[model samples]
Target chain A: AAGVIQSPRHLIKEKRETATLKCYPIPRHDTVYWYQQGPGQDPQFLISFYEKMQSDKGSIPDRFSAQQFSDYHSELNMSSLELGDSALYFCASSLFGAGGPYMYQETQYFGPGTRLLVL
Target chain B: EDQVTQSPEALRLQEGESSSLNCSYTVSGLRGLFWYRQDPGKGPEFLFTLYSAGEEKEKERLKATLTKKESFLHITAPKPEDSATYLCAVADTGRRALTFGSGTRLQVQP
Candidate 1:
């Protein structure tokens, strides 16, 4: 089974710079969620998209924005990077309405996270 | 606000030892409860999802049971490979994002 794919598995940037992280979700999965895991902390929800539309938002910083493309892939764009922005970024995908007792609830499969370091 | 709390910040076990990890959660309306295993520096691997109280699921040496307010992950005859952080997360009704617990770090020794 093909899993979610993330690009630029490792990244480094200086303060005030810009970075973009890309994620390719699993085939046929219509929902994509992004999360940030800081050192010694649990994963925090950032944002999510469904069918090219912004479905939900969490604690994502104002300096950061994300979008899902027509291909069902998504990207997280960060600007004026700060050292505190360094962390592991993960992308998870799930299929909604896949017939089941709980059609709205689906299992999310995660991709190998991208490690971002801002200096 | 949805909240998840996992107990025993860390655990150490010898090979073949059996134990259980606990996760207590509070949500306005329950959508799903999820268990994931995460290796250091890697993304969380999906384990199980329990939707309602009295629900149970199992895989290999692991079993998960859920109630109205909490869940348990029981590991039986564990091996060193099972060493990792176990995370519990919940989705509330109409919410697309998950609220995660701090996780329980398990160290299995040979």
Candidate 2:
């Protein structure tokens, strides 16, 4: 079974630097979601996209921006990183039953996550 | 604002000990309630999804039950491998994104 895949399983950066994270959603899955989980904290919703369009946004910081491409892959860009930005960034994918006779509720499947550290 | 609260931030049990973790949530027009298991340094693994009050779902040694106000994750005869942080989240009609509760860390000792 195919699952969501995220690039750069680990990342290290310094303050005032920029970083980019990529997500490849599961095949046939139409929705992509991003989350940030700090150490000892629960995963916080960051942003989401459906069909290459921004669908929703959450607690994402002002220095962070994200977009989905026509290929259905998504990228999150962060600039002027802070130490607090160090956390596990997770990308999840789900199917919306788009263009199908079956109507399915949103159910998410998460990737392994990218661990980012700001030094 | 929507809120999800988990109780007893941490728990420890001997192998085969049965216990339950509680997740209480307050949201408008609940679309779905989900349970996930997260290891120390990995992303969450999806467990169960309950759509309405009185709904119940189970997998292996875990069972999840939902009501109008809360949800309970009951682990039966758990093994050490079952130890992990259990997280609960809710998707409301207002947003496609989920609001998560601080997870309950469960440790099963052999």
Candidate 3:
């Protein structure tokens, strides 16, 4: 079975250009999450989607937005990318709403990541 | 505000050396805590999750322990391949988003 998959493993874009990253969740998972990792830093929560709706968002600027379609795939869009937006973007998926204490289905499985460079 | 802090920003250890990394956190309610290992140019891979105080989990040469205020990842006689950044996170407050620490970078030299 294919785990989470992200496209364009590496991307280089000019400032003010829009960048779109895609993610396909596990075969049957229903929740997708996006995270950003800066150099020498830990991954930061960007946003999460469940049942085709956004469940939560972190402290990101308005330039970043995400959408989930059909419960199996998601897309992260950065409009007018800034230099600060250069980072590794990771996509994760897990079973839907399995968020309690004892269930492992809710455990996140991460994709390799998409390295974005803004120049 | 929920926060997670990892100590020693970086560590350099030789093969066969045993050491530990620390993750201290402060949150409103204790939902769960997690540990992940990330190689260069890769995303984090989940290692373990601790739900409450006094919880412990082990995998291979790595052991994770949790307390009310902090968690620790202990490496036993590590190998060079164990070199990677270890991150700790808490999923409780701030809209159920995970608050991560600036990870501990470990370099194991052979």
Candidate 3 chain B has its poorest 10 consecutive residues by lDDT at B91-100
For each of the candidates, the C-alpha root-mean-square deviation to the true structure, in angstroms, is 1.0, 2.0, 2.0
Top of the candidates by TM-score:
1
Candidate 2: tens digits of C-alpha lDDT, residues A8-109: 999999999999999999998889999999988889999999888999999999999999998899999999999999999999999885313232247789
Q: Which regions in candidate 2 have their CA more than 4 angstroms from the true location? A: A97-105
Q: Model 2's CAPRI class? A: medium
Better candidate by lDDT, 1 or 3: 1
Pairs that collide in candidate 2 are none
Candidate 1: tens digits of C-alpha lDDT, residues A1-119: 89999999999999999999999999999999999999999999999999999999999999999999999999999999999999999999999865255624688899999999998
lDDT of 2 at A14: 99
In angstroms, the error of model 3 at A55 is 0.4
Candidate 3, clashing residue pairs?
none
- What DockQ does predicted model 2 obtain? 0.63
Per residue, candidate 3 scores C-alpha lDDT tens digits across A1-119 of: 67789998999999999999999988888888899988776888899988898998886679988899975699998999999999999998887556564432246888999999999
> Which pairs of residues collide in model 1?
none
For each model in turn, which proportion of the native inter-chain contacts is also found? 0.76, 0.67, 0.58
Better of 2 and 3 by DockQ: 2
Q: Which stretches of candidate 1 lie over 4 Å from their true place?
A: A99-104
Candidate 2 per-residue lDDT over residues B3-100, each given as its tens digit: 99997799999999999999999987788889999999998999998887899999999999999999999999999999999999998876878889
